[model samples]
Target chain A: MPMLRIEGLDHRWTGARQDTIRVGALALGAGENLFLHGPSGCGKSTLISAIAGVIDVAEGAVCVAGRDIGSLGSGARDRFRADHIGLVFQMFNLVPWLTGIENVILPCTFSRRRRRRAGNPEAVARRLLGDLGLDPDELGRKTAGDLSVGQQQRVAVARALIGTPDLILADEPTSALDADAKTAFLDVLMRDCKAANTALLFVSHDRGLEGHFDRSVDFRDLDRGGTR
Target chain B: MIGFSLRSLWNRRFVAGLTVFAIALSAALIVGVEKLRDGARDSFVNSASGIDLVVAPRGNPVQILMAAVFGIGGTGTAMSWESFEWLENMPGVAWAVPIQMGDNHRGYPVIGTDVTYFEHVRHSGGQPLQLASGTLFIEGQADGAVLGAEVAARFGHAPGTVIVNAHGSGDVSFHMHDDAPFTVTGVLAPSGTAIDRMVIVSLAGFDAIHAPHGTPDADPLDAAGLAVPPRNTRADHETHEEHREHTGHDHDEGSRAAAGTGEHAHPRGRDPDGHAHAPERLNAVYVGLADRTGVLGLQRAVNDRAAEPLSAVLPAVALTELWGITGTAERALQIMAWTVALASIIGMVVMLSATLESRRREFAILRSVGASPAHVVRLILTEAAVLTGAGLFLGIGIFILAARVAGPVLASRFGVQLDTRGFDARELAVLASLFGAGLAAALVPAIKVYRATLADGLSVRI
Candidate 1:
């Protein structure tokens, strides 16, 4: 079974009176990197919200780690996501008040399973940060708000991969970086994700990132043709 | 969780401090009022309990009580010598202590009374005045005076040291009886009463300083009745002339003993000639009734006196009335304090509410990181709890600091001893209620965070 399996997923925001997101089928096997791209205004945001269990899934199955998340309640889905899927958001979403390592340890604060899996979570975070080119002293020293864009992006990637979740969802995490830095950071992020044997779902409108992934797909290919 | 909350608040310490200060000021106000009210009432009840009645020229009872019992405000008017002589010798009158005030020594009011005052007056918990050192002034010992414990301790006045009297009851006086300086004969033990702030002198001491020319004017207010012996014929008497120039801090040793012979010459075994010069007036008098049941009859008799307009007030009744007057003022203060406290709670709510717009992204980001909506709600509530809890603690700190700085000054200056240690049950209840109310206010914003639609918050458009 694949690490993530999606089939016939349909979600509609009740107040908006339109289907914000609709998907027929998608799958990513263990350790497979899929580059999903689309221009602005193509329901990429809706898919991201749906994948994170933030919005309700009207119809379909979102199976992660072999368990269908659509069958779980709101709280359970949240717990399931925390335990299995690591989210790397678009804009380097590190909690500004925390130091870099503190931000990486945030997911473990929410999930006991991740805390147990990390085995001395601080040590693991330091090692993963070291792999992602953030020095040990810098991880413990600088605040997330004080770090440069490239440094903050690396820290965010380290946070998502900290507990080695089965699925890594990178939502345009490199969009803020310069072209040279983007290529360099993607190399480190892919190397770390492949080492952990985690499937990487990289979403970005810029197709330039496709070269770093094993396969790529346009987000509109999976959209259900309807009043979306 | 608390650590995280503190860090978040630390980022906004300046704004947080303003909130804490607002809460602190209101808390300190209520706390100080409660303390002062409790302390004042206790002291007033303690000192006024033993004295049954205060008989004086008819006036505002609160004013009379303030002037006579508390030695506050200005002096009261004098009644006739006939009234004092009459009341003392009355059937139900156990004893009467005449009190006269106009002169002050180093800011402490000087009250002139006979030794009967030392024998009759009682203070805190019904304790009588006891000499801490030296003896009570002998009647003929014109220069002898006694000091209250605080006056002696504060002014460093010891027996045999003479202190010049200022002409009025207030702290600063333009006129001083430098030639009529009274010798400090003794210091009274600390009675924790109003007397601790008084200077007790012989009634003769009171009259000598007020006498016009060393020839005792029995009633200066009614000079027409005093048959002044032709001035030169009474040249042997201590003339107020020799004392006139010695004003302010200057004093004349020769005039010190001369002033004592004016009127209240007590224990002075003087010739019948000296007794003839008795002062003809008295300020308020403390009259002790032989029987408690006879009080109403005596009060009615004093009030209905055909000879002079006089009124007698029961000490307890008058003091309670005073409390009623001040209680209104105190209640106003409490209402104002509580309003400030209400504003503080509202301020906390508004402060937290103001952050919701900006913090939405922080909340959404937490949700994306697998934090349930409930977690977001908890984070906001936790921040509120910490805010209020810190503010309450800060308020208590401000109160303790004030009491430490202000308690002793009040105790020494006003004879009001405040207990600053711990909260009484009522005070604790008030604090607890404030705590509850503060957290409840914080929940308004917490609930807002909980019910927030955070889906768009997590998604990036581009």
Candidate 2:
């Protein structure tokens, strides 16, 4: 089964503009990397919200690891997300008060399934931080707020990859980094995704990093019916 | 969840600390005010514990109690000596001690009574009066005086110190009875009552100084049908000799050694049953009944006396009436205390709500990490609980410390003994309610965050 599958999805904002979003179909297989590119404010975040089950879709189904999350209640949907998926935002990703390892092990705190899968959450968190080229000993001593931008982004990646969720969602995860740092961040993120055999859905407005992914798609084309 | 909440609060420690301090102060005030209120009531009630009734000339019962027992206000009229003799010999009367006021030494009330005053009167849990030094004066030792613990401590008066009497209870008295100085025969132990501030003297000594000068020494008890010879002729002549010896010196330092003074060498010596110099009038009398059930009957009988207008008050009933009169003020103080606690809780609500605006992004990050909105609500409530719980603990510490430090001063200066046993059921209930109030108030901001859209926090606005 695919790690994530979305088919015939439609959503509309209840405003005077009544803007709408539509997607025909999308699927990400296990251990695969898919790069989705779109301009800012092109309903990309709205689609991400729908895929994450933050908002119920007006039509169609969103399935993660063979379970239709759209059919689940709000509370159940949240549990499903915690157990099967991980999300990394572009900026301000870390809960600034938590230490680096605390942020990485945060998913396990909410999901017993994730905690059971990870076996030893702290060890797995430290390994993930080390794999992302951050010194676990040094980073664990300081709060997430004390880390530099590049270091914080790496920690965010480590957090997403900690429990080896079925799919990793990256929402412009490397946008804050410079060119060299962005390239380095992508290399480490893709390598870690492949090692965990976790599917990666990388969303970004930048297209220069497109060649690093296994598959590439434009969000504008996917949401063909979306209006400004 | 608690870990997360604590770290978030610590991040904003400056504002959180202030909120905690405000809560602590209010909690302390609530508990402190309660302690004092209870203390004052207990002290007032306990002051009249052993004595069943207070008999005084017709007046307000509370005023009569205040004057007779507490030495607070002046007794309006002096009942005639005939009425006191009648009350003393009345059926079912266990013991009666006459109290004559209107004199003081160095701001302490001078209570004129015989040895029965020491034998019958009790204070603070039915404990009888005890002497710390020397002995109780004999019945006819008219020049002997007993100093209360506080009076002795204040004036540095030991057993042999001679102190001249003054006319009134005011701090400053111009009518010094230098010719009628009395020797301090005993010093009473601390009683934590008005008695601690009294200078006790025999009724004869009180009459000697107040009697009109140059009149033949008269015995008022003879008019009350007790045939006793006039005995003050010899007492007056001895007082005159002592006045001459100490005329040029300070009266307070008259004779430090009772034996050395040689002035007490007299022929009338100690007359054990002598009522020879009893006064013509008495201010009030404290009475104890042998049978508790006879109190109401006796109280009515005394109040109905046709010969002289008198009021006999059940001390406990009068105390309850006094407390009732002050209940409104106590309730006002209590309401003010709770209001302060409410204001502190409101301040906490404002602080939590204010921080919610800035913490939107933080909540969004938690949401993105699969934390349910309910989880966010729990986090906020947890923060409130921590603040309230910590405040309660610190407040109890503050209350106990303040009580320990201020207990002695309040007892000595105001006669209010604080109950310092920590965290009684009432205090615990108060603290628990405060915790509940904090959580209830915190929901204002928690629910706001609960209703917020994930996109509101996830958006790049912050």
The A-chain TM-scores of all the candidates are: 0.95, 0.96
Pairs with backbone N, CA or C atoms under 3 Å apart (clashes), candidate 2: none
lDDT per residue as tens, model 1, B1-462: 778778877877888788878877777777777777888887777767578888888877777777788788753556765587677777799988888776788789888877778888888767888999999987645567899888999989989888988778888888888757898999999877788889988776776676444445353412322334412224323433343333222334435444423233322333233322234456688899888889989889899988988878898888879988998988997788888889998998888888777777677667777888777777777877887777777888888888889876887788887777888998888788887888888889888877773544475222
C-alpha RMSD over true interface residues, each candidate? 1.5, 1.4
Residues A25-90 of candidate 2 have per-residue lDDT tens digits of 899999999999989877777777877778886434678888887788888878888888889888
For candidate 2, write residues B1-462 as lDDT tens digits: 888788889998999988998899898888888888888877777678789989999999999998888777678868866688789889999888888887888777898888888888888889999999988887767789998888888779999999998887787888788767899999999887878888898877776555433322343322322222322455434444444433222334424222112222221243223453345568899999899899999999999999999999988888889989989998898899889999999989899899887788888888777888888889989999998888877887888889899987787566777787766787678788988998999999888878773446345354
Cα-based lDDT at residue B405, candidate 1: 90
Q: How much lDDT does each candidate structure score?
A: 0.77, 0.81
* Model 1 residue B206 CA deviation in Å: 2.6
Clashing residue pairs found in predicted model 1 = B139-B266, B139-B267, B140-B268, B204-B264, B213-B240, B214-B240
Alpha-carbon shift of residue B34 in model 2 (angstroms): 1.1
